[model samples]
Target chain A: MIMIILFVFLCHAVTFCQIEFVKVPMQKKRPIHLALYQIKLPLPGVVSILHRASGLLLFLTLPLLLLMLENSLHSAQTYASLVALFKHPLARLSMLGLLWALLLHLCAGLRYLAIDMHLLNNLKQARESSKAVLMASFLLMLLIGVRLW
Target chain B: MVSRVVVGAHYGLRDWLIQRVTAGVMALGCLSLAIYLALHPGLDYQGWRALFSGDAVRTFALLFMLCLYYHAWIGVRDIAMDYIKPVWLRLLIHVFVILTLIVYAIWSVQILWGY
Candidate 1:
């Protein structure tokens, strides 16, 4: 990008430079030395990606959740069976996972909506909102985790 | 040869609009639902069944389900497109997603008005 800018700059200033400026030779190379842990992704960016991941998690678990709801409302017997299933450690763990996904998605989604509506315009506001989103998700997760237990 | 007329991001405009519209509705729907559930404390099986037995709640559930499925379809479709490179595999997964959402929609209808 800098090289392209310099080329354009030199083209404008130099008399001998060809002015046919049709194609800009661009470097197709990307960041090959990208170390995931070393790079500090801004809070908003982190939240954005986590939103996508949490959404996928929710999507994958939707069928099972729908089944659970169906069975719970099926009959007294089925509801009782669901309650019994809820007692299993694995069931509880999966439920917790789903809850976290829901919380994260919901919070991040609201943040996005706020941004789209221009509720948070500046970088500082974006950072603050993202922080609030994460904090709210964590607080809700903790509250619900305790309640579920 | 098919002549391509449509150009640029406008091609995705419909999907983008559907995504936003469904997202807004679902967000509001979820908030209202949470409020309703909070008001009804210690809801038992009978309470739940009677609640959905009413037409208003059933319609609300069905409408939200539609919006949710639409929203989810776009989201999942985008994800699969991004991560799943193989064209055949991507198509298979996309078909499975569509079929599953359809089945879930039917199941939701059954649950809401099953009695």
Candidate 2:
């Protein structure tokens, strides 16, 4: 009720002053176009996603890794059996994938540590760091691959 | 309606701090393990057991496991909160993850000390 009275007095004052009014449409709700495939990720953005992906992969497989540790610790026989399991082609492939994941996660995590320390302040430095991380991880994985083979 | 305005503000700084702290702890643990491995090559089951049998390394490794789970909780929680739109679903996942990490901690203890 008080708001209604104030509006009436404001209307009278506006009329006395002969102020012109302009109309505008409501644009509070705007359309958003967010197509995932249409978007291009920057180098650092790609590295960020890969970091999360690798972490998630490692996380989901934690149980299996823990089981391997358990077996290795159980006894010599069990430890030999676990070592034998690693020789299978499927096992080796998955091991490679996991190694790569660990490498990527580790490198990206170190990069994040540097970022938290205010080292990668500029866009160029961030991008370069991301590139360096990817290269280092990939090269490390390849080195592990050669040793594994 | 009940207000849900303050959920995001309070936990942000704490979780950020935890994630970095846990990362640093785990990094140190891994670095020490790597250095040890570099010094002692061709580790068999006995050799590996000897490494973990030490009190200091074993304690640090256990600490690393705890940090890993806590760090993982924060990361996975953020992922679920981002990608899982349904509140109930995210809550369910959060609960499951908490339970699983608890189990993993127990498993780590068993692996390190249990026969």
Candidate 3:
């Protein structure tokens, strides 16, 4: 009976030591192996990230846009000057970019709202909606760009 | 099985709701502006001024501005919480952002109602 107890205790001790050793290396190796750049995100992930980017862009530009609106509405002279500024090629290009960003953001926001409503709760539907958003926004941007040019 | 209860500042639902509501408001504002712009093409000074001259439009614009600020605050705060881990640094950033947003809010009011 004493010999059997000793053997069982030894087995338990060995297994516990193995577990501790394995856990230590895993904890140590995790941060080094984690690489964000190496990961390939899916479509919905890309759309979600772009939504954040566009939101940030819009948030940052709010001041500039408000200032422009204020200046344009301030007086006839300022308004004319603003119009002339916008007529420049660089300004038009930037305006186009902003317009596209706004449209894309709006589309993505609607998709998110749908998801929040539990409309597209499944992965497949979510992916399809994200793709639809991308295509629709691109098409709208192209149409608007043609009109602008 | 053992279960653990987690305790923290629980404002997630409130923030989520606020963001959605403010987004809806902003969307409405954008739609109105788009319609106005489309109706009045080649918008010059007087035309632009006329568009905002109405009491309804001005009120909507002011509401839009307020919604924009709140929407931005929630979004930016979430971003900061995600990327900035240090407690003190995150707090400092939060302060700075709050101050800037307050300034913008005041500025927006001045612009909209300064006539």
Candidate 4:
């Protein structure tokens, strides 16, 4: 009888262990489609994304700008050549683009700074500020563009 | 008041502050440059060279370039952290970025002060 009881206990322990070791598959939900044109992001969100994009654009173009500055400062000949290059319509257009990017990035950066300081804490204030930023950037761009062209 | 315990790299505050400070410096530089350019419209080679010939302006320009390098580094590093998931690949990309930024820094110094 004791031997039979021991055998039953062993069987029970083995079955329990087997059950504990069984793997369960996790059920994951499908990801939502993130179509850019189909979805309308908030004004602040759009501004924020543009801020990042402008920053990246500025960073990528830094080397070229630096080279230009260096060449312009190097000597009279190089500086004259660069000035002549800038006289081209295409060069002026590109410069206008860079100018706009710089202005937009600066405005957005100031907005971020204000937000960080808790000056624009509320959603309404944030939205208004973002709109102001956009308007300011465009106005400044236009002013600079006139001179540039 | 209950104190909160935070873990992980905890680089957020420092990076944020640095970015803002560097941005401020760059803004000042840009303002000065803009004013000079506006004042001297149709600037020729001699005029342009004269603008950067000042010791004070050269120093400011150098400082601006250094700040720009740091600012770009932090910005790019944050982007890498957010988007790059694979550990080894992310690390490799980071190393590459650091190297490139270093080279740019050195080149900038040469360009600015080499003459």
Which has the greatest TM-score? 2
Each prediction's whole-model lDDT (CA): 0.82, 0.87, 0.83, 0.83
Instruction: Write one digit per residue (lDDT tens) for candidate 4, span B1-115.
Output: 9653321124568878889999999999989888988988888777766766787877888899889888888877777677777767777777877787888888877877777
Clashing pairs for model 1 are none
**Model 4: iRMSD?**
1.3
Task: Give the worst 10-residue stretch by lDDT in candidate 4 chain A.
Answer: A21-30
Residue B62 lDDT (model 3): 84
Error of 4 at B44 (Å): 2.1
Pairs of residues clashing in candidate 4: none
**Candidate 2 residue lDDT tens string, A1-149:** 99999999998988866543322222434557699899899999999999999999989999999999899888999999999998899999999999999889999999998998899999999989999999999998998687557
Candidate 1 CAPRI grade: medium
Q: Rank all candidate structures by their DockQ, best first, as comma-separated numbers.
A: 2, 1, 3, 4
TM per candidate: 0.81, 0.83, 0.81, 0.80
Best by DockQ: 2
TM-score of chain A of 3: 0.73
In order, the interface RMSDs are 1.3, 0.8, 1.1, 1.3
Model 3 DockQ (Cα-based): 0.61
Please write out the lDDT profile of model 2 over residues B22-107, one tens digit for every residue.
98898888778767776876779999988788888778889999999999998898888778877778888888999999999998
| Model 2 alpha-carbon drift over 4 Å, by segment | A1-38, B5-10
Give candidate 3 regions above 4 Å deviation: A1-38, B1-10
Per-residue lDDT of model 4, residues A1-149, tens digit only:
99999999999999987765553322234457799899888899989888878888888897789889888878877877887998899998888888888899999999999988889988899899999999999899999898767
Q: List the candidate 4 regions with Cα displacement exceeding 4 Å.
A: A1-38, B1-10
Top lDDT prediction, candidate number:
2
